[model samples]
Target: MAKTIFNTSEKSNFILNMTEEQYSKLASRGLIASMLLVPLFTIIPEVTDKASYAFSAGGLAVGGVICMILALIGMMKKYIGKGAVIPVIAMGALVLWGVISLINGYDLNISMYGYHNRGEGLLAILFYFGFFTTAAAVKRETAVKTLINGIVAVGILNSAVSLIQIFITNKHYQFVSVDDEAMAASGLSMSPIFLAMVLTLALAAALIGFVTSESKKRRILFICSAALFSFVIMFTYTIVGICGLVFSAAAAIAAVFALKAPKSRLVSVLAAAVPAALAVVLVYAGAIGNITSYRTYDGRIAWWADAYMRASASGNFNSDIINIDDPVDVYTYMNEKTVDIIQKNPLTGTGPEQLAFPQVRKVNDLTEIEDIMTANDGIFDKDYNEYLYTAATRGIPSLIALVLALVPALLIGYKSMRKRKSAEAFTAFVLTLSGVLMFFISCSSIAYAPIFWAAAGTACAAIEKPKKKEATEKSANKSVKAEKEAAEKPAKKNTKAEKKA
Candidate 1:
């Protein structure tokens, strides 16, 4: 009866399949592998017609399958308590709405996989939900810091790729560029805009590491990495990237002031102003334009199969969107169209991946350049805003579920941030806060969405209160220490009395 609940074989730590610690480590390994490898994926355009973007989907599928397995295993085995699953349940609701939307959708193929270049479809959403669940359900350990470190590692590698491409040789890394934008660097990601968001995520984690590190070497390392990530983020020229960097840095500085700020409040204020000042100078100098528009609307290639292979190979298909001259125009038109899409279906609007070619002039022949020039119905694929996009695609309840998924973790993370809790908790808060805000203003893609979800899951894990077992162990240890002190007190008193005598 003593150990029957968890049968263990001798010389093995596998109890009831695997311990919670092992489960979490495996999940981390899977997630870290994707974070490190997914963005770096690429293939030559000559190899396949869909070479520009299919590899990313392949990476998502590989990573998603692993995450899904871990999530299902954890759910079946009851790795986490019932109370810990509220955020996950919220995520499940998002998935449920997505499926329902898919079922009611006009085209199963389009809604299931989304547009070709931008795959924000139901399948991709399912994968992201799996990742969020895996991250949230795992029992967080001190080793959770590794996830932050992994982002830093990705930042460093991507920075190196971009730096070399900028100063040394642009022609060297053709595979790195999914599009032909020579002025900006995209690292191994699909586009510079998407890469910017990823670097922002890395920058936030590195800033946290910099603030919390006590050792001089570690501080130097984190600061250098943060600077590198931030520099590349500027080159990407995305508003969300720049804003996230400044906000996350400022937030981290505020939190760290509790530990080791100069007594003068003036010094603290100046310290916080530096990041803002840098951003201002960069924007004013015109070094940073809105890279978001570079990948903006009018991308003609939506679905490619055997039928479109010849058309694609013959150079009839233009995969990029028609670039608008002004970012304001781009945002305005997309937002207006998004509203129309939402209004049309109000409940589970248009399904996931339903709207690719907005107000199409010729829906049948989307590839021809002649047709694309005349038929500019704002060629919008994904909506600029994530909140509106979620509501438009999944419906009002799904949007509420999305909010529920974030709000509780956000609230807990805020508490952890204010209290200056453990490094893990504070880092989680920063990750979740910055990532969520960044994506709120941008589209949800596999490129940046996974990071946000992973952050949310990590935040969920980090902000949990201590368990009853740990509380009991702590009390027992304290009582033992108290008894030992009581027993020793008389001996010390008698010795003192003898000396006095």
Candidate 2:
């Protein structure tokens, strides 16, 4: 049964083994590549200039491609499972985006050549997809824990550097000095996404550590570290960065409450009191009023209003007319457009990145105003709208597929919730759900931020089995061994007596 159920690939001895010397060489090479490429991408123009292009293409892209090739090879050798579905779906989306761009595109040549091939554009997308796929393949909880630890370690090191820089240079940022020019030289500056991600991971680790820590010293250290990281996140003030931290905190608290309910009723009651207290404090301090002035929220409201208006004016359901002057009229208009688009292209969308529908095109035209032009020449600024972007980029089917991808993760979280597993897993699931909701909101404001990845990685990692399960299995095995030995002794004696007779 074992033979039929599992691969016997161990018999083939296909795995590569490295001597100490070979291992040393590989480690050295990896370090050299990291040192050379990190600063190169950090200081220079992001992913657009020649040097940046080469670094991303050769360093990041090549690394991802290598991983993908190795994964494929492993699959062929039966060393990896056929659960290669996500990568396939993501890659398929890329292909669909490309092909559809050609069929109904304003810029056919650029579309075919991979959107001006900017920033090692196509290759970079491929790399990230492969990187995610590799991450998904990691099965061991220890390995996942180690990866989270590494991120936390880096964040700690970077935070230390940030503190030093703040004191020595009298600047706030460490890895990326908050210099006047605002160019990023370090993780904190250049990759706020990475920074925010690490911050959340460190917090998550600290929470888990605190809960499980037996030693007072370790608990104090972890609690202090978590507090410091939270401070650092606040100082950075990347709106999304702050939001990610907030989301993570809320999720973590919620998970703790859920997990504590069964064993400690008093503690759970106290935990429940926290939100009520915080809400009271917020109202007292006028923090709730402060939320009204939030730039991101204000901007989104304005943008959505405008979109509703435009969609209504055109009498075109496919166009984004929801951003109109009259909310009542615009709302009516958008419903009509939704009905129209659903009637026309209910399944696969208008094709990836092809928003030539009259309504979208009108907004595309309006956004060309000098006041509204964003970094990407405004072609991608207002196009920042996610659902609209999804509809435009991959049409309806791909949009639906993206929604479907979201479902599995949520279901896993729900299942974990039902089982009353580790607090970390429940926190992760709720945080991920919140992050996904935030991502939808962010689609209209900011593009894909790194915090999304951080939240996602945490949520995915949280679903893993706890270390105690393995210990339990080992203990069960030991008990079984003792029982078997006791039974065998009696049988052996009878056999020996029979032979002697």
Candidate 3:
């Protein structure tokens, strides 16, 4: 009988076709690109000013698009698996909107709009791609730590550079209003929004480190770094960032307590007091007005008031029922605008490129601005609202697709809570919670699509446990084969010995 040789090339081909590792690597690269792009975008915005926001919707935004492309390719090749579906759905919706905007634009014409619209749609799609891909590629627990560490490293470097620049230029003092010499001063920095986002990432990572790290050295370092970031955040006076941090801390404490994590009573007491401590800091910093508003929680009531009034007038009471806070009202107002736009254009919405156009038009006719006076409010021009931006621009189908993509990831996160002991599960829990916060804060935050995709990937990676019995069975089979071969070898040796004798 002739011995057969296994085809190594065929096995290699099979492995190459099946492994998620390649997709993961690409996903990590996408994340790295996004982080680097953040600072670069800040620099460009500072220098050019005209094209500052463009880079955000351009290069950094394109990262999400590329990620979606890679994810689609991976799915087509069968390497993506179930984890890729959410991103694909998000990307699909974005692409559909992009196509629609190119064709059925409601008289909003700009040579740059299509380019920017596609870019925006692509950007949102790419976020999901990078997020999901990272989840698929990296080990669940390790990826979360890596993401945190990466954010911390970026925050530290950015903060240090800003400090050094202020020192070197001898521009130690700056004014917030450009005329108020008595106002608080800070180093060279980007807009409040970008600064807030970085600080938020750093804060989240620091909280995670404080809770999970075993090393005294790392714990100390995290504390110092967190304090520095918090101080910087306050100096920036980005109230939104401060609010996010407070919420995250509250979330961390709640999660820890619920999990019954091993910790001292002192630690638990401190955790319980965190919100109060944060309020004190906010008051001491002079960032807030009227501390009693904090007690009644009336300080942030404007958003809900705006939402309820608008919803009541629109007769859209269903969406505005949760007017308990400014946050809910803000979310309702944003989503309602989108819901309104979507009712008109359900198939594609407004098109990815025109995300802000419809909202802008709804509020003002730029050509007729002199007649309307609505443009005087400035909010219509800026379009800080997310739901309105998406509905007016990307349309409703894209938003629906976005919701579908995110909901599954949320389910996965919910499942992860079952594994309360695992670090990966905790990270997913945090991300899912963050997504929820972002949703109520503004639909635009979750509407990015990429965040949700990443959330889904993290959820899947965290919850999908390996079966120990299957692994044991494989090990047992290999041992049995080895013993049988050994027994046959002795029989062959005896036959040879008898033949020689």
Top-scoring candidate (lDDT): 1
Order the candidates by lDDT, highest first — what do you get?
1, 3, 2
Each candidate's clash count: 2, 26, 11
lDDT for model 3, on a 0 to 1 scale? 0.48
- lDDT of candidate 2 over 225-296, digit per residue (tens): 665565554433344445655655555455455665323222322322343244334434544322212112
Ranking by TM-score: 1, 3, 2
Tell me the spans in candidate 2 whose CA falls farther than 4 Å from its real position.
Answer: 1-40, 43-59, 73-99, 102-120, 154-225, 236-238, 259-385, 416-420, 423-431, 443-501
Model 1: colliding residue pairs = 298-321, 299-321
- Report every candidate's CA lDDT: 0.63, 0.40, 0.48
Candidate of highest TM-score: 1
What does candidate 3's lDDT look like per residue over 1-501, in tens digits?
222237445544542454344444555556555555545554554345365344545545555566656555455455444654564456456555655654666434431233321233443444555556555444435544555565566567656644443223213223322232212212222333334445555565565566666777876776666666665554444344556567556655654565555554225224324533664566555544322122222112122112111111111122234442344453445466555666777665555444334544244434542222233221221123444555556566656665665666676566656754664466555665565555443333211334334545656553233356579999999999999999999999999999999
What is the alpha-carbon RMSD of candidate 2 to the true structure? 10.7
lDDT of model 3 at position 56: 48
What's the TM for model 3? 0.63
Better of 1 and 3 by TM-score: 1
